[model samples]
Structure formats: C-alpha cells, structure tokens
Target: MTPDEISTYEETLGVLGDIDHRVVERVLREAGWSPCGAGDWAVALRAPDGRAAARISPFDLVAPYTVALYREAAHTRQVPRLFAHRRLVGGGDLQIMEWLEPVDADEAAGFHRALAAREPEVAELADVVRRVHERGRRDQPWFAPKLDDNPDNIMRNADGRLVAADLFGADGPRLYAAVVDDPHLVVTTIPEPERRFMTDIPLTNTGPWPPEVRAAMHESLTTADTTHQA
Candidate 1:
C-alpha cells in the first residue's frame, strides 16, 4: 500500500491516533522506514544494538494484537522476549521485539521429534499450551493457530529450546483455550498455506492420538463449537 494509505489503515486498526502527521513522518524518517513497501505496514528499524526489531503496521491489527498476546504468553513463558509497545505521536503503533532467527525445516523436524519423544523438556511446550488455554478460558478471544504455530514464528535460543514468537490473530484468550481444548481441530481445519507451513514437520496424526491428548482435543473442539452456538 502507498504510504498515505498505510497511514490510513493504521488509523483504522487503532494503531494510530489523531495526531499531527509530521510526528509519524519524523519517526519513519529517524527509523529508516523511508524505503516503503506494499503491505499495510513496514519494518521501521533493527535496534542499533541488534537486540530488537521495530515494525510499523497500517492495516489489520495483527502486530499490536501479537504484541498484546505475546506479553500475556510471556508471563507463562509461552513466547519469546517482547521489548516494547508504543503509539506513534502522529499515527500507528510501533512494536519493538527481540530479534529471532526463523526456524528452518530441519530444525522444525527436530522440534517435532522432541515433541514426540515427550522428554521432560517437552513438557514445557504442553505447559505453554495449557497456560494459553487457561488464559483463553478466562478471556475468550479469537485465536489464530497459524500465527502461533508457524515454523517462522518458532525460535531457538543458545540453549536450543523452541520458543514461540508472533501472536497476532483473533481473540487471544478464546483461541488459546481452543488450542488447549482441541489441539488438532484448529490445525486440521487451517487453510492450505497455513496447513502446509505447519505440517512441514510431521507430528503424529490427530486421528489416533494418545487417549488423554485425544480427550483434551475433543473437549476443546466441543467447547469451541458450543461457544459458537451460544
């Protein structure tokens, strides 16, 4: 989108407030986001020390939502480090987050193996998912599984642990609960792009899950369906 259009979209998404456009222009200029691109937002800067990346968004409130959920997920260690959140004086929201390298296919495969192995550390993943579910039950927000589960959003630390990155989607709380209640249901129904992205690592088939996991998944799906009906 054009820069002006991007500004408009940011306003629509509540990323921007009714302030002088010059303020936003200044931030963009200082941040080196002058070289604009199509998407509703732009990556403004990579932190001087290279610890975080600052991004600006105009369309779809994904980034801000992601920041919000990431903050919540951080409490339970379901997500990586979140640096900062700020509203631009002119327009749009700025999200600064710790920079993380995307997980590659091979790495993703390893993560899958770790999950399947059910090692003690793997329990952390389940705990993260469970925390998300508890938060979802309490908040009832729309959740986007793809964003949460995509390999691109997964990261590895120096210690070689898998951590979630992005968070933007629908209601955070509701979606988190749905995932915990029915892990496979959402993953299975995801569109082709997301499905392909997530399925790159071959996890066990949900059709024949371990009894406890299966029961939990069924319960999640049922809760989601019932929520929709109500």
Candidate 2:
C-alpha cells in the first residue's frame, strides 16, 4: 500500500468516534491488555507477558451476530471465546475477545492440505467450519460466508491447532458500500495468498461458489456503480 493509504488505514483502524476515553481505558485495564495492533474495524491488544491478547472493537452490529453464529464454534473451541462486555456504559457494545497465537501461512496451509487425506486434525477444523455455517442464517444479510471469510482467517496457534480469526462479516448494503468505497483499503490491502488452497474450501464441495454469494458480490459492485452514477 502507498504511504498515504497506510496512514489512512492506521488512522481509521478502531477509531472510536466520540467514544469516551474512559471506556477505552476500562477495556484495557479490565482486559489486562495494551494496544498492540489493529485490523480494518478492530484494535488488537497484547497481554503483559504471555502470547495471549484481547481483540477489542467498538460496539458493532457484527459483533453480536458473530457471537450468536459461532455458538458451536465456541463450544468446540474452533474459535476464541467471544466475551460480550457491557462494562462500558453507553459505549455501544464493546467486544473484548481472546486473541489466539497465529501460525504462518505455510503452516496453516499444511494443515489445510492434510484435510485432503481425511486427517483427523483437519477434519475437526472442518467440522467447526461446518458448524459455523450450519448456524448461519440464509435470510440474514450476511449469509454469504464464502465471500466474507477465507483460509487466511484461520490460524495455527502454538499447539498447531486451527483457529478462526476475524469472524465477523455482515454482508449487506453497508458491506457493499465499504467495498465500493475502497477496494484496496477495505478488502484487499493485505495479500492473502494462502486462499488458493481454499478453492474447494466451502463444505458444500461445489466446484464454484454458491449462486447467492456470486449474486451478492455482483449486486454489491453494481450498487456501488449505480450510486456513483447518481
């Protein structure tokens, strides 16, 4: 990314507009963490000593939906336990989540490839993915899991186990707007090369993506074009 764009991303990452500083401090103190890094919409904080950390984001609609959708994932330890903290009064819904240690792309790909062998480890991870999708709601705006999520979002921690990260994606007009607004800044700023292994990722085992996901993608881009025209 250009220096200007990086600056913009840093500025916008986890930017709390008009949010009270007290809330940020509370989350940091209570979570026993300090700011370490960030993503498009969330701030990642590291623990004082260990590899553990907390990923905190301002109250957002996606947080609640993610927590609900990953019920089985949380149960099966496919994902870090999502904590809904109302401790910040009037600060919307602050999400303080456990941050799992991330294994490099090659390591994650190794495990994913093992799935082709029907390996138990990969099977368990696949099962967690299955559960996540099973709980997904088609009627909901964010039903297109294939488009929103990817293998790069999966992490191999210290234990060599697979964990899902960046689990919240609400597909709708808002998501469309974000992509339309800036394809690089919001969508592809970071290179996700490991995604090639996931051509057959979706459990559906279909050759291509679901019809609905393709339709949603096309609609989002088209809507953006139409909006620009007007």
Candidate 3:
C-alpha cells in the first residue's frame, strides 16, 4: 500500500497499545474509503474505486487470520477473494477484498428460502461452510464458530455468486492475554457463551484461541471500539 494508506492504518492502532484512533478514521475517510458498517471488532469500508471492500481493524490478527483462511483453507470459493493485506505497526491490519454487492431484504429472504429448499447454490454454500469449519477445527485454532447461520452475513459478487462474508471472529481477552503478559490483565467479565464453550472444551473441536499460535493478534478489541467511536 501507499504511504497515505499506511498512514490511515498505523495511526489508529488499537487495544493493548497507545496510538491515536482519531487519526485512523480521519485518514481513512480522507483516503476515500467510505464507511459501510461497524461491528464490535472493526469497521467495514468500500474503496473509492467501487471494486473492492476493506476490513479496517485496530487489532493485529485480522489480516493474518484472513490471509491464513484464504491461503490455508481448502474451500474458499464461497468466500470473498482477498486482494491485499497491510499489517500495521501497533497490532492492526488492513485488508482489501472483493466488493460484494448488497443483498436486499427480498434477496436475502429469497436466499434463505432457497437455502431451506436446498437449492443448488445454497447447497454449495452448505458444503463450503462445512469444509471451512472442519478445516478451522483441524488446522486453525484462532478461528471461532462465527459464521452466522443467517442471510445477513451473505452477499453476492459482481458475477452474482454467493459470497460468505465475516468468516471469522477474534477472542479479545484471550488474544490480548496471549500477546501481553500482563499479570494485572483485568478479567473484565465471564467469557460470552461461545467463548466459554470454547474454553470449556478439551483437546479438539472447540476453537481454542491458543496464545502461542494466535499471539500475533495481540491488539485489544477495546481499543478497536474506541477507534470506531473516534
């Protein structure tokens, strides 16, 4: 990425570190990536050219997890094609990806209907999801079972192919603890059901956010939340 683009990322470095979150948002807007949506973890943006979308995060692991998914996962046809990834200095990542078109309420509902009917396209989606989940359990521990079982997380490519968006999630406390050895690290609250479930499970199956393997995603989600607010 260009220096200007890098400026947008590096400045808004998220949790577990000190950085200016305001600058990250300002620069991203200035760079012409219009904000599309915001979640607990990151902000979604559409590129100026209209051909690509971006997952902007102040967390360090977003890019690595995404890149790993695209590269290591056996099935990815249903997922958006990653274009580029920029790892920031303060544990954040910027990902450029294929811009999937919006699915209107009707379209989304129709997709669900088709999914229920086990139409060819939706059948393919199921297969893809199963394979990805299987791989996530066997190979990628950083991955959590986050693919929502609904149409909201579904989109379509330019060619009208079904695309699964937001394929993974980050475990904030686990990730932060993994990266930083802060004995005083506050146990904010009990892990949410999904996280607790993962923690409770033993050797296999559950998505264990192993510190050694996922330490690269050390940035705090609290920081991302602040950045998003900024």
Candidate 4:
C-alpha cells in the first residue's frame, strides 16, 4: 500500500470510535470477518476479502514497533506489509496487514539452525533478519526478541518468502490477563486521555485470572507505555 493509502486507512479507522472491548470480537464476526486463529499474546481475523487481516491485542502491544519496522523495511521483504494501525476507541490497538501463513515451528527452527551451513535460501533468510535487526536496534527500543528459540515467529507470505512476524511484546498475555481481571486498571495503568476513552468498555473474557498474572500486571504497568502511531 502507498503511504497516502496508509494514512487514509488510519483516518478511516479512527472514525470507528468507541468500540467496547467486550463486544469487539462479536462485532468483527458480525461484520463478516473470519477467525484466523490466535497466538498467545493476541488473536487475529481475516477480512472478508481474505487478502487482508487484523491483529487485535486486549491492550496495545507490538504494533507500534512492528508497524514502524515494516514501514522502514518496506523495500526489504523481511517483514509483513502493514496496511493500517489504530488504537481501539475502548482499549488496545488493531493492526491490518497482509495475511501470511506461519511455517511449522520445527521446520522453521531447523532452517534457522542451518544458517551457518549457508544454504542459499537459509542464507537469504539470515540476510533479511540481519537487515530488520539492524533497523530495529537503530530505531526501536521495543524490538527485542529471542529469535533463535522462537520458531513460531516465522511465517511465509503468499509468495513463499520466510518473513518474520510478531517480533516483540512477550509480556502481552500476562498484561492482558491482568486487565481482564480488573478492568479498572485500564483507567489506572494506560496513560491519561487514552484511558478516558475506554471508561465504559468491558472485557469479554471470563477468567480464573490467577493472582500471579495480576501481580505481573501491577509490576509492569508502572512502566507501561503503548503507542498507536507509527
């Protein structure tokens, strides 16, 4: 997508004001979006067109860094093509982008291990990773990931390129559980005016949100900062 198109998408999304977190999924389902499966930190939905998808976090997570990374790396093909990103009116952020199918973890891990062996394709993957890493180190504080161990982070685009996906935000699940348990934390944790926008939003997840998760949230929220703009 062009830069102008991205800006337009951002504007269009902002106009969808005040989406309560409680009915967010139901809303998407009713709008004809289909489940594209979920990961530990967030869930995803594919648009009716099937070529595009959206990733939703109960609260903002990696979209800030990921979107910026993709924009900067647009010429490199190492990351997914991001189309649009905007914070939900209630809480969290929504990221729409080109949908990619994930490669099997074992297969991805094996390919990663073969980097040193210099197989042409593996070497290409290593080159791409290095480029994205260099950009991340230079521009993003939230871009850290243990790529060597996490093979599930690898995905293949429609063109068969092994691309990196969800390269940050390991703290997502714990933070989400905490928010789900005590929705008021949305007011206390996320900084000012943004929290005010979600005052009436309720979480849909029913939980045995363990005490440790809440504890983790309290500890992290002190330093919590999530951004919607790239």
TM-score of each candidate?
0.45, 0.49, 0.51, 0.61
Cα lDDT computed for each candidate against the true fold: 0.47, 0.47, 0.54, 0.60
Residue pairs that clash (backbone atoms under 3 angstroms), model 3: 15-220
RMSD each, Å: 14.0, 13.9, 12.0, 7.4
**Candidate 4 has what TM-score?**
0.61
Query: Which candidate should be chosen as best, given TM-score against the real structure?
Result: 4
Mind giving the per-residue lDDT tens digits that candidate 3 earns over 84-147?
A: 6665434555676777876876777676666546688657655555565656555544446554
Which stretches of candidate 3 lie above 4 Å from their native place? Answer: 1-27, 60-63, 71-77, 104-142, 171-230
Please give the lDDT score at residue 16 for candidate 4: 66
Give Cα distance to truth, residue 60, candidate 3, Å. Answer: 5.8
What is the Å distance of residue 146 in model 1 from its true position? Answer: 6.4
After superposing candidate 4 on the true structure, give the runs of residues whose Cα lies further than 4 Å from its correct spot: 1-12, 18-24, 110-149, 170-208, 211-230
- For model 2, how does the per-residue alpha-carbon lDDT over 1-230 read when each residue is reduced to its tens digit? 23553344234324544343245546466756677665443456665554445544442334545555445556656565554333122322344444566677776566556543547755664565545545554434434454244456667555555766654454434443454455333223212221111112222222345667656554555454455546
lDDT of candidate 4 over 142-195, digit per residue (tens) = 335444346876778888887766655434344355555644454354554444
Candidate 4: the clashing residue pairs are: none
RMSD of 2: 13.9
